[model samples]
Target: MGRHDDETETSYITVPSFFKCPISLDVMTSPVSLCTGVTYDRASIQRWLDGGNNTCPATMQLLKTQDLVPNLTLQRLIKLWSDSSGPGSSPILNPPSGTKVPTKEEVNESLNRLMTTLSRDDDVRIEILTRIVRFLKDSDTNREFLKKKKTEFITLLVGIIRMKTTTKKKMELVLMATKILDTIKPDRETLSNLMLNDDGGDCLTAMLLAIRRGDQDSKIEAVRVLDWISYDARSKLLVAEHDGVLTETIKLINVTDSDPSLIEASLSFLITISKSKRVGSKLIAAKVISKIKDILMTTEMTSVSVTEKSLKLLETLSSKREGRAEMCGEDNGRCVEGVVNKLLKVSTAATEHAVTILWCLCYVFREGTAAVERSNGVTKLLVVIQSNCSVMVRQMAKDLIKVLKINSSALSAYETKTTHIMPF
Candidate 1:
């Protein structure tokens, strides 16, 4: 009771007696029950057990065991009560009823009505599309149903996006369609059809516009669709041919407040586009090099997928003279430092790409060789060779080390470090 007295004296807001933990006398976020039939917040009880006490705080009854059973029903009721009540001591309202899941037939009917309404009137089209989007968000089964009819949905979506409607409702319809298409992931043939539209591929144009003007969620969906489309070589070329696709994609990378998923989609699209040398050069021209380097140096890039995609794109870009020059030319040496730091720090895929970037720099550009040697890149490469890297990576590391040894005298200082020596 000593702790209860201190807690009660400190709390200004009056908590319901049942809602307070018996041990801490505070409202519980996670309530659990002891074997003695007394409830306490999980953390408070855990602390009590850790302190070697085996008695219930409320009843002082001996507890047979320390195991805590979660009170899920109570937790939900507490959350509901907290949400409804307020400082003025208002009465708590009952939680709303859960929406029932729509059946597959109902989902199909909604889609049919949506397609039919598109031909009827603008108001009907917008309302139906909104309902469809809500249904799509309801469950994965609804999304899979839409995927089964991907051809029909893709055609309709492409047509709606191609129409030059600028009304707010029309724009909302376009955004919803984009989100649904992204969820369905139409096959390569369907995507090819979108690119081959008679209106000279207006679908890609519409997506670019969405990336530029839509809200964050819409923009994310647009980029995800674009990423899926870019899986095909022809589709990749079509996307790169668009004027703003590359620029807007890099802009998304630099967006400070974007969700991690959005940046991931943007990075994925860039990784696909970077497969083409022509498009890779365009990315370089758009100042993508510095932006990618910035991502590597900052703490924001914590997702391993993001780091891997960025590294893969860097590998592709580094194969070009322009990319190598830009990376080696950074005033603060972050580009080289970032690649070197990832030598064995990230996943195997990332490490391979990082080594490929270093290889390109060391062999393709004369200035690159000197810059890398100066950045302690040779030491990192040697570490990779000695570590438990894949055969391909170890070979690449050895090849880079040979290039360094042949090109510069700086490697001689670390000659004794090569325990797993490679034959020339």
Candidate 2:
């Protein structure tokens, strides 16, 4: 009777297809992740393991470790979903579960449902899109399933942002639309075509509008979408061709007291897009250098990722003669002073990027030597050579030492205890 009741209650919105376990094909109240990245209900996986199975029933791959990490994100999403649906929402069973990943049939069913719901009002669209974002973010399997139907999803999402709706639900649906595209993410081929295709399915245009929309979260997702596309050199160039793209991105980076994560995303997009000289010129013209310097010098930059990215952007800018000139500023090389101060203090990656920036300005350009000296860059470079830094970084430091004229003769007095100038 209890089993029969559980099956009959399936007509309720207990699960959204993705919340099902592969082993029992049952609703997952407690989704746990395996080393192979598959999620299963706790009881089902425990039963499977106790039954002498050492493989993930979903992928049939050998289990690297038996420990099951709680899929807290999925669990929370499931909870939020159930809470929002209440007890009287539309019919939805534990949805469908599949081996390895969601079956093609199951994914098609979900997307088909999405298409229908999207045709409704903005309130409905926002809820469904939010759920979809959660699903995409929940697991690699969900995204893998969506990637197969990227074009349809992209078109549908782009259409939502392009819609002239006045319902104005929370998150505005447009933001959620951008988030969906950010998560599912059009591949390089799809990105390139979106730029070329003119049939009103222009994701690039939607992103441009999202940036202009000025909603902080939406703009971040919008920038991320552009950043993903710009990872490819050709696409980077293609993105640079769009009007106001660099300007808008720089605006994001230059904002005051902005969210740290948003700044990181904006910087990442800028870094990828600035790969070409033309784009670099545009970014430089937009005063991206001083703005980045301000960010590095002003913000606490507790996030190592943000700090590394900031230095890298500066380093990328340094590659251009104009950039090198900007970094080796006329303002007594304050920019150079900043880069030199970062050496050996941050992560290896950051230290490496700082070293490269210093190498370019102080060595290749030979313009920031005075500032490097002022910042005690010579002392740091000596330590860098002696530290367990990367071979390339250590060598760069060595070259910078030579280029900065920190030879034995100059350091003779500092190392009076030794006949040879050890540091130099």
Candidate 3:
């Protein structure tokens, strides 16, 4: 029962990418069970196969002797092994057992079938490709499989990007391709070459173009990809290498007829880029700062959500003392005063988002309150806080009141003495 499969028999497990150990590809081998009771690795499985008896990876079911013929289809298995062993050879031991071993040509034929189906709008094709991609991810033989198909895979992805199709199908393919790219970390040099080709920027640039022209959801997905890339330190630098793309993206946010959600996505991308100090400064230098200021000051931006995002961008910009000073000073007034005035105006907005905007303004004011007061901003803040009816607005007033401290006795003693005076 304990006889290891690889003891004398050539184990069918493909050699791992970085190792030479004969591993199981049918089910996991040498699996370790975690504290959470999830098992991994194939050989560690406790069940013994009677000739072909293999345990289920999940349920540990004692599979029938006939079931051990790698769960892959005969055509797929043959192609996999044939490709591994080279011309006119079997890669794995397949002694009948009712499991047909696929020939290399058959595997190629199957892939051609998949591609044909992909061109059609059949759900079966979509499911098949998804399953194939997932199986490739799970199998031990995938490295070799991918090596042979890398060029075809890249072309397929570019085709998916270019296909004129329903948004749902387009997004599904995009997401699936994204997952594949993440899993494979494909050859960067090759990908870069494609990006430079007239047709190369197909997927990446397609995402950007979709965001610029497509509906809100499309734009959101596009930004999500941008955010993912920006999160990578190397990708952040690559984004900056694009000539004037960042500036153009920021300008899109200012479009009066642009999708509000798209604007939010654009701001989110900018925020991600801003996290990198070098890129943040470059964004500011690109004159995106002036555009952002114009949006923040627009009375026409009545969408509370839009205004909140504007405030968020402003908050990020003002996070640095230098950025704050540059912003406030650029408008021909002291930084703190101008900021305080904007906060006061927006604090009265009827939407909940206004509260967030006020909070950020107050945060900046707290940091630069001294600079603001020196520029005569205290009276402005006090005027809003003292008279504003919204409780939150009133609270902001009280908080800033402490910072301004214009006649402390009048504020503190007036409340106490007025508490006892009766109109009757």
lDDT per residue as tens, model 1, 1-424: 1113454432233446678665443578899999987888898778767756777755667888878999988899888777664575443221122222334554565567556522344544664565567667787877777778857777887778776646776676677778877777778667666755663367777788789889888899989887777766767788887877888888888736666778788998888888888888899989998887876777654578877888888888887888877888876557877777777777888888887788667754544676567768877887886677666667667678787775545444444433443221
The true-structure Cα RMSD of candidate 3 reads 18.1
Those runs of model 1 whose alpha carbons end farther than 4 Å from true positions after fitting are 1-100, 117-119, 199-201, 299-301, 364-367, 406-424
lDDT of 3 by residue, 117-157 (tens): 22343333454356456545555466456545747766665
Q: Candidates' TM-scores?
A: 0.69, 0.67, 0.43
Residue 41 of model 3: what lDDT? 39
Q: Please count the clashing residue pairs in each candidate, in the order shown.
A: 0, 2, 13
- Model-by-model lDDT, in order? 0.71, 0.71, 0.50
Ranking of all candidate structures by their lDDT, best first: 1, 2, 3
lDDT of 2 by residue, 52-74 (tens): 77877655678878999999999
Determine the C-alpha RMSD for candidate 1 after optimal superposition of all C-alphas: 19.3
In angstroms, give how far residue 416 of model 1 lies from its true place: 16
